[model samples]
Target chain A: MAKSTITFEDINVTVTVPAGTRVIEVSEKVGSGITYGCREGDCGTCIMKVTSGWNHLTEPSVLEDKILRENMAGKHNRLACQAQVLGGEISVHPV
Target chain B: MNKLELHDSDGKPKAVMLSERVHWVGSLDPDLRTFDIILKSANGTTYNAYVIRGSEGVAVVDTVKEGFADDFFSRLESVADYSEIKVIVLNHLEPDHTGALPELMKRAPQAQLYISQKAQSMLKALLKQDEMSYTPVLTGDRVSLGDRTLEFLHTPYLHWPDTQCTYLAEENILFSGDVFGCHYCDNRLFNDHVGDFRFSFEYYYAHIMRPFKDYVMRALDLIEPLPVTMIAPTHGPILRDRPDRYVRRYRQLSSPSLASEISCDQKTLLIFYISSYGNTRRMAEAVYAGAMQVPDVRVSLYDLEGGEVDPFVDLIEEADGLIFGTPTINGDAVKPIWDLLSSLTVINIKTKLGGVFGSYGWTGEGVPLVEDRLRGLKMRVPIPGLRVKLIPTDEEIQACHDFGLELAKELMGLRSQKVLNFADLA
Candidate 1:
């Protein structure tokens, strides 16, 4: 129902996505630079830090939480494929 | 356009400073392709080496590939004199790191070569130099370099049995060979500059370190308490800004969570047996009876003698618990048991309960050996292996049954399921 602005800090790119859009899909639409392998949460290829608007993203699944918790990624970090736009501006730094 | 110039003005390889006296002298294969003939290295790769200048003498941490000898030596010579290089520390004996070792040993003939105890025979066989003398180092072992101290951590199977991680006490830098490494090659040589190398790092782990996850966890735990400011791996960019991140990533990747994710709902138990004289087969039946005593657990028994009578492998993959019954032959488990164990390694057995039971004549080492192997595969062993000598007595058979019950209880505990006591149900 709402739009969220997703900014890719590394490439200085940004795109607008509807509520609950995955970060990987946003990156694909805007040609934002985000390297990924296996796209699934298991491989951890699309790990990215939410530089801002952490609360704007959707909740992480059990698998994503497990992997992120394992990698010692902070609350600000979320796998691009797993984290969705809940509805606000979110800035990301791919790790 | 290499940022470090680890090469002189005229393109001759040179050493670049990492901190003050610490230098990076490893060579880069910009055009090189694959790594270990398995993983694809699209960005090529780097054979990282380090030169630490202590107050008395210098120490070379590792070497580059053999084909890059000229470049490697040039870089080594650019920073310190070969004769002044007092120590050559080899964290691993893999060819990628030891390819230029023979030439390096020839150049720095007087330098002491340091390797792990497990590496002694492996290095000899790998280099084909049986008589070469090496100083064997172990976990917590230290070799002083006048002002700085190099401590060795015997972290085996970080990819190889002989692998070790070297820590520099003064700088608090850990020379972690292949432990936190990837095949990523770039002029930007630090995690801060490289942005995110998650894919390359994950790919490296999937290909190289997946089979030896247990060791990876052990190494992480072993190094967690150290005041490590930097991680200089044998490949890719060094982790300086946030070395802890990589360590945490390793812990996450190696966690049993990945293996346990297979998700089996039914409590399955596999009892496989090989009978030399029917004694072990009887033990298997006794254990199966005990396991069947517990409710809701699906039990599958397979005689591994003829091999193809049952789909033991398919059953093993689905089982939540495993029990092996074997006859000791010359103080060892039978060949089929060994073959089955080897095949099980390729399957995910983490978080599963495992036990060994066997019949022995002169030696009872077979069960214990199987237990050790199962433990090595990261299986949870809830009870000591049941070993019955010769023909099992009624008491011995009961003991095996009790062992099986204990294993079943442990499995229930692991899965956090309530055991259905027939008395309580009644």
Candidate 2:
């Protein structure tokens, strides 16, 4: 399995994990301060900006997309709990 | 519309009529000393129920308390027969509103029950009738009885989850369950005819509805746009004389500014604590003072032991920063603090600045445990937990103050960063 690196810009920390790792998991591993609730893409609390490497993350699920639209989040926003690292480096910041 | 023949010998109407089609079929309890074991009802109260005759069938909105079923049934019978009742609307499931429900269902066996979607489980549990069936309604759902239409608005948590308001389309009357109601029992029936009840009205708001001010605001928003000529609540006199004034008063009372005088740009920090020996109270005061020192930050300090936690839930939900103070007893934080934390699950407090501070005699596990819980709830804790041994010295108090100041600064920094990020995105 390929590994991907996630850079938490606000907390100034980076972590490398295997592919298919959720952004929330990487956040917990490095204490990157990306706060989340429900952990199931329902609360819209873990919304973060995809500062770079947008293609490195998986597509948002239907529920996540609906929540993002309801929150009026822009195209750059993704719920950390719902977005997974595919295979490349990604950089994000909590909104 | 004026039918002078309907008046009794004394000029008082035998049946309280709000309009040509709607009638007040409710019971008055002028002797009620108290209500729900908390509200002090000096002038007693009224269980306001209404009967809407729609040329085809009748719809009954709510009922009196259990013991007053006879009064409710007699009034109901005067306007329409038990068989004529086609729809029963339960706006709220509280006992005072639904106490006569079991009997009413028995008499009006063919009538269908309508309630908010959230009241499905509550209906079965409250009446202890597992087989009871009801049509769950939503915000825009409506039911027609020939000519008149009843539109439901899902205005929940005005005080209870199952709470809702019904609008009479033709008459423009809002059958609000408990909102804009008081504990005053008056046979005059209408707000214009009743004696002064401003005290009871405000008192009712403070006791029953104040705890859920955020929801009150939400409920107000839902009902404000309607062309309501009258507000017939489940309690107190029906508001037909300038009903909008009462609605405006509810809007004023539930406004966020009434809780704390913080403007939109300003931040709010809340410090909640429970003290067994006044130690934690002192610590909370110091934290409040420290947080207040920061410009554009409003601080509120509450002693949880003396007050109920429900009122603070909305305040905390709107706050930018929160600090919990406790006195560790038997290796744990007090029950009130834990109760308050548990209640936060219903609201999203994610990324809000959180801190834990307390005074303990021996083990200071209370502070760290709360901090861990806050972290689990997704709150951004900027600093470690602060603990003081037993009573705090002058230096220890200073440390507590510094803790609050640091947390407030971090909150301010986060707000600024958010503004900058939004600007960049724009």
Candidate 3:
């Protein structure tokens, strides 16, 4: 597994993540700054805004997109577990 | 929230907003703690009212609660200066929405109360009037205002047949009487304004609207293509936040997946029995009370004498849990307990969980008999059957609520087997 660097805009914290790690997983490794429930993505609690580095994230699941378009998802948001980190720099605004 | 800020679905500001002819001077029912068999978070329900500011003449849509006629009149006063109105549209003949009709008509002597054609005879029968200010407009009927128009879609059995929804094309707002309503009474109206929005919508959908599945589906299909930006129903907050989210939920409830979707966690049904002079009934209730504390499992209480075991049998046959209780008899089980156990054995119905309860004068008879019966039925008894000689102490009752929490986990392992609404099985 390869490690990648991740950053949060609100907390000004940086963390190293292994390859194939999801943004949601990276979110958990950092701390309780993020809120998520039903990790299955049914509940719309874990959405966040994508401030930058969206290209490094996996495509949003169908349910994720639906929540985002409804203005229910947080800023530039993507489901953390659903969106795997792809060995690149990423920036996110916690919602 | 600004009224003009409310936009049509096509991203246009509401160029035409209906006049405030009708006002919701309705009261909330404090006693209505649980409405339509579901617990309500909102303390009470409000009556929705609208006034039509027509180019020809003003029409008040509906009135509020019984005691709140003055407020409705005040709202109507703000909409139009005319003391005499032209038409008063009665979308639904239900009392809360129509309670103020007589007084409203008296105030507006020139106004005719409009109702559906199907509802025409029903209202006349209810009101017992031959020439009361009534106008019967059913389907394909149009009420035109110089600036705007109201088209009636007679929604049959969507709660009520007289229940018709009006569409304002120029403003693109659906004066949907009650079809898309919540029980909210907050001043902060609209979807986005209400935090924790999904629960209210689900409560309305699951309890109030779920029963009328077919009519709801037909109604949804009819409006799916319409350019609806805002939905003002007869109850709850106005859907100005994000109308699409509520609309999508309605669609999901109506979709075919409703039959197959297992929304609850995997759990077995828990049936508890309770009785008073019927001591066994107490045991049944205690067992049920116990199982309910458990999460993820469904609990049902059967009274050997009080409850009919036949109707709830499907819940029993498919459930992974079971409980029985009865009062003591001449050192023997009560007749109903014997009958129920015999019925279970005859049917060969079995489950993964089981328990028993009973009261006795000299000694307990029901609990032991119940255990023997369940064993004969080949039903699985995971926990030792509970026996109470006389009445249960406070600890005994605590045991019941606690029992529920434990079985909830056990039942969680059982899958929800379909008894109805399955195509292949059907």
Candidate 4:
């Protein structure tokens, strides 16, 4: 049970979160502006680009991975519900 | 094959009701209406898996999709005798209909799998995974329900290869698969007590069976002679009350489309967004400039200006592809685009592709934001989407060319893809 601090770009607000938390939930908590619908891991709505810390995030879910497989994931994108932050400092853009 | 789950005292067909073994779980995409979401969000689903009680043996009919195997089993345990299941009647082999086959067979080893001959081969080709078992039945194969009779009718083109319908003469029910079915879910099992069956049935016919209207017409002709009181589909509520009402509706669907009511085949490109200063509109026009290069791609753009609440379903119906453009609003997409996205709850369009374009000053994911909303509609988008910074650029225009070319190919297929292979089937 490890927790780590995550940062948001614009506001520079950081919050402690449990390990394996998706950037989406983190963004939601800090109000970092991510749009998402169909949270069942299909719709690529909650996708975010791993700008700085891709390693801190777990691999995307099968649905997200499928989108990537089809080469449709937005540039540097991953679904937030499916992506987990192993947590450290990470940069995410809600693309 | 049926082992006779229920029978009248004089050896006729009867049950407290049929197949107490079935269960329905929550829908995967409630927001997605194709799965006919009812009973808390499992869209367009009945999750039908029935357990039969027989004198000599027991069996289950159909199964939930792989995603809902756990749910199917748990629900089966509540009403039916699961441990004694002897045979599983697989009327069709669509993955959604057969997703739990392997899991169910493994758990109930004693039960024999029963499927139509065509369905057996289709299932083999479909569930190509090894270690499967089944008993094949073709037309006239009668499965005894102790004293009652379960008859098999081979309906090859009932939406899929090797599809068939099962008629339990004793119970006077026809377990229809994709045919004569709709995409709506309800807690009530019978159609008699249910709300509007009109929409679900029409949607199913229009979306799934509209193209195959001719065979459906022939199929209707074949069923005219049978005195069926109940029609239970794999999706939506069972029709026990007025089965003919649904049948008449199906008949009308098979009837020829009037020249006036025929949905226009004209191509449409749906562009969605909000432009503050005409910067995004310029980029969108560039995308359109590229899209128009391909012949016959009619296009429409929505500014979402002045709080327009128009859902634009006709455009959704017409478009082969959708291109979205939006500038950053507050921290998310402009409220207008968000409002449009929210209203797009039901899009029966399938296999449509898309693109996202935008321009903004110090943009915080403007193009990506709109693209995400488009993806929620289940439309595919080609890679390397154009995202112009502040205005359309040479590179953005180049990206636009690629998007148009990719969409043009897909639209070409819709126009020319010989979907009417029924002549060969017949």
Scored against the true structure, residue A24 in model 2 reaches a CA lDDT of: 83
Sorting all predicted structures by TM-score, with the top scorer first, yields 2, 1, 3, 4
In candidate 2, position B328 carries an lDDT of: 90
Worst 10 residues of 3 chain B by lDDT: B417-426
Flag the better candidate by DockQ, 3 or 4: 4
Q: List the residue pairs that clash in candidate 2.
A: none
How does chain B of model 4 score on TM-score?
A: 0.53
Q: After superposition, how far is residue B116 of candidate 2 from its true place, in Å?
A: 1.4
The candidate maximizing DockQ is: 2
Query: What's candidate 1's DockQ score?
Result: 0.01
Which candidate's TM-score is highest?
Answer: 2
TM-score of chain A, model 2? 0.95
Tens-place lDDT per residue, model 3, B215-282, is 88888877777788778788777776567777788888666441243444545565655455744555
Candidate 4: misplaced stretches above 4 Å?
Answer: A1-95, B1-86, B90-111, B115-165, B169-172, B177-229, B233-238, B248-265, B285-296, B305-310, B328-350, B363-365, B368-384, B391-426
Model 1 chain B TM at 0.66
Of candidate 4 chain B, the 10-residue stretch with the lowest lDDT total is B417-426
In order, what lDDT does every prediction score?
0.80, 0.83, 0.62, 0.62
Q: Candidate 4 chain A: worst 10 consecutive residues by lDDT?
A: A5-14
What digit string (tens of lDDT, one per residue) describes model 2 on residues B254-329? 7765345656677888888988888888888888888877887778888887788777886786788889998898
Pairs in clash, predicted candidate 1:
B7-B14
